[model samples]
Target: MKEKFALGTALLVASTVPVFGQQYRAGSSDTMDQNNQQDTQRGSCCTSCCDECCPPKDPCAKCAQLWPSCGPDWIITPGAGPCTADGCDFFVTAEFLYWAVRQDHLGFAVTLPEPETTSVGEISHPDWRMELGFKVGIGWLTCIDGWDLYLNYTWLRPRTKNETASSKEGFFLQDYFLFGFFGPPGDFTLDNETAKWKLDFNVLDLEWGRNFYISKCLHLRPHFGLKGTWQEQKYDITANATQPRGSTQFFDTITGSADLKNDYWGIGPRAGLDTAWHFSRCFSVVGEFAITALWGRFDSRAKATQTLFDGSVTPAEETTTTIGTGSFKTEFHSVKPVMEFFLGFRWEDWWCCDEYYTGFDIGWEVQWWGGQNQFAFLPTETRWGDLGFHGLTVRARFQF
Candidate 1:
């Protein structure tokens, strides 16, 4: 009986040892799994903290995301002034110009007397050349909203000269009877003579314009203006005469000079449309078209003088002067049309200030006038003319 009881006790101990070993293995696996879970949670927290401290990769995207309230209409400038806000309140501009003048009626016609009828001989006039000009303007924002007042002045001058010569063996009769005062009306042989022609033109303009803005980039301006123009022309002739010793003529040499002038003044109303299209922050295209109607007066004057030399007279040289004076004037109404177009590149925030800006433009322009009333024709007749220009323009602006 004692042997059987000891064997039973040994069996029970062996069974208990196996059960304890299984429990220990299970507890070790649970501890390892808990440690791995804690490590993963701590790593996730560190990653989130790093993300918050570092800057974003794209700045534009970040700014847009942060300032979603500011729309495209918002203007942000780096300087301070009224210009930094929305639009230019006050401004000034200076323009350099080059233009060509086209006035065909500003020429003179000369005719020689014929046996039966007078025939046209020669035509004389000064050729119009390209001329330089300038303009200056100032503007102010008025009390009326989107309305501005501006004043501008422009000036230009062009000049030309021509020389011609002719000779004849018989009586030289001028179809215009006024030229007969320079010499005797009889037949004579003439040699070596020269004629000179000179002309000068001047133009001035002053205008006051009121602008109504349709938007930030478009506007219509109607204007009232004053215009003045002056033209001066001179013609001179010199000749040497060979006459017989006993000839009955009074003079051996002749010289004549004639001067002509035309002055014009007008007051008018003008209207224009101005437009700008911006394709970038600093570049744009601009265009303008205008028309004006003017009521004006033209005043003309002509004068002539002649000197005659008679070698056969007392002192071997004689000088005589003759004067011809006349006035031809007219009063008329006219219309003028002008067009301008340009492609411009602008630099904003110039001189490190938003109130300062600079721009450059290259383009073409044309102007036409009707009923110009030239001095070359009869007082009752009128003429038309046109002018054109094309070149580069530079502009600097101060906004306040």
Candidate 2:
């Protein structure tokens, strides 16, 4: 008998389930059914019929009549219940239904595009000479996310310091102009003074290679490329007494400059590694270390023109005249190894995030060469100077 009773209860609950939901009656201006019939009889004309005079037919009445538990428990009379389905179990809720169809459905279909890698290189050297200068590089990336095929150029002008000379005649200044030709005939006249030493270096590199991701946080790049470099240095020096009041002498002078000129074309393989750590969606720290082995010959030239008043001028000679032209050229084979490093922060997808990136780096570079210190017609010890530098870099890029 107990089992039979339980079975009957289950059947009743199941049968009344459909009536437990929201209902609408045709042409009945009422929102819900009221217990009083007086309102229903008084006004079938408008929706404001009072409950006491014109109670409308119950929308849930048919099922409620079969299963009485569904009438007041699950159905609402508009003003008496909350706007949502709350006090039920195993049935869908109003809040759940609205969210499943609206918010959740839209967010899942929108995704950010894949990130693009570029073929540009940007680098810097701090102590380029003496003035605290910098260098910049950029290029283009080819097929594959991190691979690049590039042409790059860099510039640097280091700081200068004053240099002293023993005699004005010893103050040697080149007579080369913009066209690499001799300047006006004139001896470098330094009234036994000191002048600033100037230093400059520049390069252009054409490289092709791929940057491989060793892990999510690390990248390694091994490249083969060609490089061309140009370098210039200047300095002054003083020599101890040894003269006929005025004598032509050859003594080493430190102009504060290392080498006067150098130019070379090199071909070799380059390798590098970069590391990155992403802490969040919008911030990351990155660093890189690169090396290039370049072998090439540098053809260089230096000239100093001296203008001496014409001593054999006629008695009371007219306007004065100058004479004599001197110059020298040199060529040598050299191999240079270059090293570079950087540390910076990367901002993600700033302009639509995945379309481009910006970075600021502080780093340094060192170049070591294997070659002769001097050559024919070239100063015996003018081929090397400070080969290390450090600086900062700021860059912007677009990914394809």
> Which candidate has the highest lDDT of all?
1
The digit string of per-residue lDDT tens for model 2 on 1-400 reads 9999999999999987766542334224253344234433333221221222323335443212111112333433211110112111111111000000000000001111123133332221111132333334445543243355656666655544443333323122221121122232223322232333344556776666554433323334456576667665432221121112134332211111112334455666666665545443234466776677767676665553332332223435423322333456677676667776667775433222112323333333334433412322234434342255444455444332
TM-score of each model, paired residue for residue: 0.56, 0.44
Looking at model 1, report the run of 10 residues with the lowest lDDT sum.
62-71
Error of 2 at 362 (Å): 4.2
lDDT of 1: 0.47
Q: Which stretches of candidate 1 lie over 4 Å from their true place?
A: 1-88, 109-123, 142-144, 162-253, 311-315, 319-353, 376-394
Question: How many angstroms is residue 347 displaced in model 2 relative to the true structure, after the best TM-score fit?
Answer: 3.7
RMSD of each: 18.9, 25.4
Write model 1 residue lDDT over 269-368, tens digit each, in one string. 6656554444433444667666666656655545455455555656545544333333354544444444444444543332222333344544555665
